[model samples]
Target chain A: SQTIHQWPATLVQPVGSPLSLECTVEGTSNPNLYWYRQAAGRGLQLLFYSVGIGQISSEVPQNLSASRPQDRQFILSSKKLLLSDSGFYLCAWTGGYNSPLHFGNGTRLTVT
Target chain B: TQLLEQSPQFLSIQEGENLTVYCNSSSVFSSLQWYRQEPGEGPVLLVTVVTGGEVKKLKRLTFQFGDARKDSSLHITAAQPGDTGLYLCAGAFYNQGGKLIFGQGTELSVKP
Candidate 1:
């Protein structure tokens, strides 16, 4: 079965610090990967999605960016974090356009 | 912009009670999906309804897609405490790759 792994499970960083969150999928190759952020137990905001390596579509232009270094490895990064950047970050993968998304456990980022 | 709206942003009900959550959209979609997420975890895909007016049941939970393919609903019969979670609805458009537009989400709490 396919599974997604994301880390660190929880993060606490001071404002203006650099951030890196990684996600990788196992049991699947060239799967579509997505990064989402949820604020205060509400809906999720799409950050970025990648169809293939080096190809990323950003939904909301903000302090964050995404990269697909390998087929199954995706990374979300930021040069400088803002207080508003803190949220529950989720990584998801899907086999195709119509397939249901499988998500990782998520990372709770707290920017103080 | 394509958007999804979910009703009853927060639901608190007792175990054994029946509740229904709705997701509505003005724009049509190729498919609709429902997900459930626990605290600090990524959303888990619960069900996907493709065809118009499609109805699918998972254990005590029932999902229905609107005839217009622009809306969907999830009904839980005799809800249990384990069923408490944040429920989200996502819609996918044809040709949008694997990107999904999510709703604001419905937070359900079933008290035992």
Candidate 2:
């Protein structure tokens, strides 16, 4: 069975600080990886998705960026955090077209 | 931009009642997927509908895809408190490498 791991589970950072969130998939190779953000209790917003190493497609233009260093390793980074950047972050992976997505537990980031 | 609109952003219902949620879009999708998420956790895949006019049932839940492949609906019978969570619908385009575009999501609260 394939599983996704994301960390830190919870984060608290001051404004204008740098941020780094990592996601990894096990039991799968060259899987498509995605990053999403959710508001209070509502829908998810697509942040970035990677098809392969060094290939990233950003959905929304914001203060965040994504990178795929390894086949199953994805990272979400921010040079300086904004108040609006705080939310619930999720990492997901899928095998291919028409496949179900598998998600990680998520990270709750609070920017104060 | 290709977008999905989900109806009734929030729903509160009593136990044993029935409810339906809808997802609509003008752009055609090759496939659509439904997901359920609990508080403090990532969303989990419930079902995927690929063929137009296709219907699938999982226990008390029934999902239907429109004939045009641009819409879908989920109906739940005898709602339970365990069903209280966030429901999301996502659409996948053929050329996006199965990248999914998510709707705003529906928050369902079933009171026991």
**Best candidate, DockQ-wise?**
2
Candidate 1 C-alpha lDDT tens digits along B80-102? 99999999999997667658989
Q: List the pairs of residues colliding in candidate 2.
A: none
Model 2, stretches more than 4 Å misplaced? none
- Candidate 2 docking classification: high
lDDT of all predictions, in order shown?
A: 0.93, 0.95
Cα RMSDs, all models: 1.0, 0.8
CAPRI-wise, candidate 1 is: high
Q: In model 1, which residue pairs have backbone atoms overlapping below 3 Å?
A: none
Please write out the lDDT profile of model 1 over residues A1-112, one tens digit for every residue. 8889999999999999999999999999999999999999999999999999999999987999999999999999999999999999999999987899999999999999
Candidate number with greatest lDDT: 2
For residues B1-112, could you state the per-residue lDDT of candidate 2 as single tens digits?
7899998899999999999999999988999999999999999999999999999999999999999999999999999999999999999987666899899999999999
Q: Work out how many backbone clashes candidate 2 has.
A: 0
In DockQ, how does model 2 score against the reference complex? 0.89
Model no. 1, DockQ: 0.87
